[model samples]
Target: MRISGPTDRRGVTAPAAGRWSAGRARPRVLFLATSYPVYEGAAEGVFVARLAESLIPFVRVLVLAPCPPAAAKRSPRARGRKRVRVVCLRYAPARLRLLAQGPGGIPASLARRPWLWVLVPALLWAMFVGARRALRGACLLHAHWAVCGAVGGLAARLRGRPVVTTLRGEDVNRAARSFVHRLVLRACVALSSRVVVVSEALAQRVRRLVQAADPIVIPNGVGPEFFELDPPSRGDHFEVLFIGSLIPRKRPDLLVEALRTVPGARLTLLGDGPERPHLESMARAEGLSRRVRFMGQVAPERVLEYLSSAEAVVVSSEREGRPNALLEAMAAGRAVVVSDFDGAAEVVEDGVSGLMFPRGDADALAARLRSLQEDPAMVRRLGQAARARMRSLGLRWEDTAARYARLYEELLSEHGGAAGEDGMERGGRNGAA
Candidate 1:
């Protein structure tokens, strides 16, 4: 990592390329996302949590998201801090129910009550005021998704702080397809001095759609501490783990069908969503009630234990931008059988690191699972291979944090005192960037 200017510290390296450590003065960044502590959508929430924690080593990061509910304001503590302080909407009555449900849970709730649209502007106003205050010492605005970034970029531009936006899956793949969303997303990416994406495919998409100042591809890195190699033979009954929301996109239903195909195979689905009832009924109807189990919403730390015990972790999502659970499974030396999506292909090279299957094909997924189940040798080989490859990849939290810090510094330097609130200043607000 190269420091843009003469860094104040002697030992710490700037968070630039080729650097392994952080500079002495950690930047204070305000992270805006759709929601935090999101229990339903495991992958996004998990990765976001890791990103925030990883950034903490090089920067003081505060995670700011709209509270899906009114209860977040009155629920428990006056303030809460865990590595990063999670701030929610102070008083949103109609939306409070959504807050109680979760970030993913709120969308449908908002849709059903069309009357709620009238309150969005006021809710955003309150959020801006609260965010501005919480950002008292923040140097830059770092938003996770495009819509939030579009709004936050405007807010940061209002406050004279640089904005760095990261485009994730749904925000780009689905939402960006909409004209309004596409316009806002492009504007957000263009206005901010820095634009970031998780994959090369995404980078190309952005380039084709908009003229970005300097777009960078920064894939989400996994923390090495989260995984450990589990011996292949520990299983009494081959425990197969599927770690994702029970949402339709994740396609947990395919996993159920896979379990049925692989007789005696015990499958654990760890999440909750609108599709739970349908998935549960399928299990009952298929007489798979005994073989398949739905363990809704487990803690992040607890996930590793489940993966550690399972013979292999399966990813059956119709689409993805590099599944974090897939990475974690690989990190744990557990073989992954993922849908053949571009993002999953980035991590899993078929038959080498992990197995790849066609998207939404339960039969294809089952056949792959049977091959691995029948051949323990292949499982061990692939699992060990995946672990070795990931270790070499250096998917550590510090590595992730350092990259963001360097990018932040680089952007601030590049902008060179652009007066736009969303433009990167020579020195970030309070000299944090």
Candidate 2:
């Protein structure tokens, strides 16, 4: 019942201020997400944090996310020059709060430890209560995932505010397979003033759930750091980087298996998940321990380091929704070998911008890696093409934020709560940022 107020970078309690009550020029947006970066440079949901940061110039952003066990005593990191206020909601006992962290996110955590289902009600209730408290002066609610959208939808209904729900990868891919999840997703979509899907594949899935739903397709954008990375010189051995959770869905094990055929390639797995131990054991059993390095969950800067030094980046996932990692690797101008998931074609032009292999096919993946290893010219060609594609597509965080800002204005005007004239001008200026 006790919701903490927003705190500054120094962890000092700030005064309770609302958008209109405080006489702010911009409308306030409350971002509801189950996963968010707890500290600066943290890899967890960095996209959400980045989007929130990019939106700051146009609107006031307040992110509400679950407090991880490690960050229980401290406040979430304030990132970028323009700070976004992040309020961490404590849902359960510190030790028992394992729902939102690690790989696979909420559904994966629940699947791994079914007993943790006991905390679901507590988490939902906590989010609802915290959202209501945070909605005091907020004009609209922006929920990151369907679960948060469901909670935000209810809160917005009560407060008579609009809710904008963004359906990320797992929320649509995994949630559609279950009856209860499908029902919840339907309700979330029904209650949303606007629905945004990160990929065309996800948008298709949303339509299947609700035929009338017209979800906007907006892929997640890469930070400027990725684009500014210097091109890596070709090494003696081809360095292949896999930069995502080691969860089953991500299929990092496929990359490890692919390495067996690619003797000249060294693989660096730069993420952590429940499958890490199993993958490590698999690597050792296959006598590939030395060749496969498991670098579990580094900071964002470290991720950029790995991306910059790699000859090629591989995404061996079985499913995805326009992965930010893929976009970032391409932006960094690294030759990418991505599995041909549903929406793979939308981002990469297969043989042109990047290489794609059949999903879950280790031999095909190995072939792609071997080709990249042997053909440095092709690698450079593809890398440059990928970078050019990103540039032409305008896949920057500021651009994405500008699109969302316009949508927010349209929704606000429809609901008779549009921002003031200054706010509209600032929203239009997002492109110049």
Candidate 3:
């Protein structure tokens, strides 16, 4: 695929023109993700949508995602994101959506409350139906999480489309916990044309599950705006930031514990989830109520403002898939103290870019915090190094989209073209152009 200059009707400017075979048309990508941005202020799955949007200029992309059934009442949040056409399929009833598809994402929803398993069947069935309807003119399928990958795999098998499944952290990490989970994970791997993971650690885990499956590691990226390099706005007291859902896996409580060891340090928690109340209470119990600020759920565009203002960012997660929170912080030139979770080593270099402590070790984390506190110059140096590393790596959404576009072309070449009803290959026509 050659990069050609052209802007599509969707308002996304194509950096390069993409090609399949010599005579084929531009490929069309249908993305399947259980979590996607439904409205403008939605904090969930904005990364998934960003990938789809980036691909729009390179290919025709249509996103088939499930929104809470009640979201129909709100105005569309996709005003500026005109690159991809999003179809929000409803899986649960309005009142039952919170129980079935909680804000913590599908896997976390089920893990936290096992009783919600009752609604899974309906969710999968709905996705299957939606995928079938959306696959009519699409040439390839890209599923974000394993659960959605399972649904996409089934639909692809029926429709004869090549499906690529991207495994984000919990989808594979917790797959072995139950029979259904394992079965779904296997189905996703078995049906995929290629498997993609955000981190090398996750790729190793997938190989252990399916020896034949070799997953490609493509780490998530940060936007250039986040890397604008504003002067450090160190306030009277050190301000640290934590941006993620307050779930058990994220270990926000551990960050709270570490904060107890550092005096005169303030924290800003910038996301909400099921565990917010418990975390809030824990903060209060430790007399950290004044130092901790819970700025629950801000819009995606505003994250850079918080990152630029903070002296450091903390990622104390039990697990991760190359967290965007850490990536954004690094790009914004902020010092970091991240738990050495599964994918942590790939992103942060200890003492080079930032510090990495063993997962769940509050004392180790506190010690690192103390080091940064004692020397403000060290914090500035580390933040600058982190940004420099990110710059050298070229971690941006544009680069990510180009990689995906090439992968789609490779899969398209193997498949020849869209399949006819009789399982015959037809001339490769991307979309209804």
| Candidate 2: Cα lDDT at 381 | 95
Candidate 3: regions farther than 4 A off: 1-14, 17-24, 79-81, 99-101, 111-115, 176-179, 419-433
- TM-scores of all models? 0.83, 0.90, 0.90
What are the Cα lDDT values of the candidates?
0.68, 0.82, 0.79
Q: Which stretches of model 2 miss by more than 4 angstroms?
A: 1-24, 73-75, 418-433
Cα displacement (angstroms), candidate 2, residue 167, comes to: 0.4
Candidate 2 shows a clash count of 0
The stretch of ten residues in a row with the least summed lDDT in candidate 2 is 424-433
The TM-score between candidate 1 and the true structure equals: 0.83
Task: Name the candidate, 1 or 2, with the larger lDDT value.
Answer: 2
Clashes of each: 12, 0, 5
C-alpha displacement of 69 in model 2, angstroms?
A: 0.7
lDDT for each residue of candidate 2 in 159-246, tens digit (9 for 90 to 100): 7778999998777876668888887888888889899999888899889887878999877888888888887787767899999888
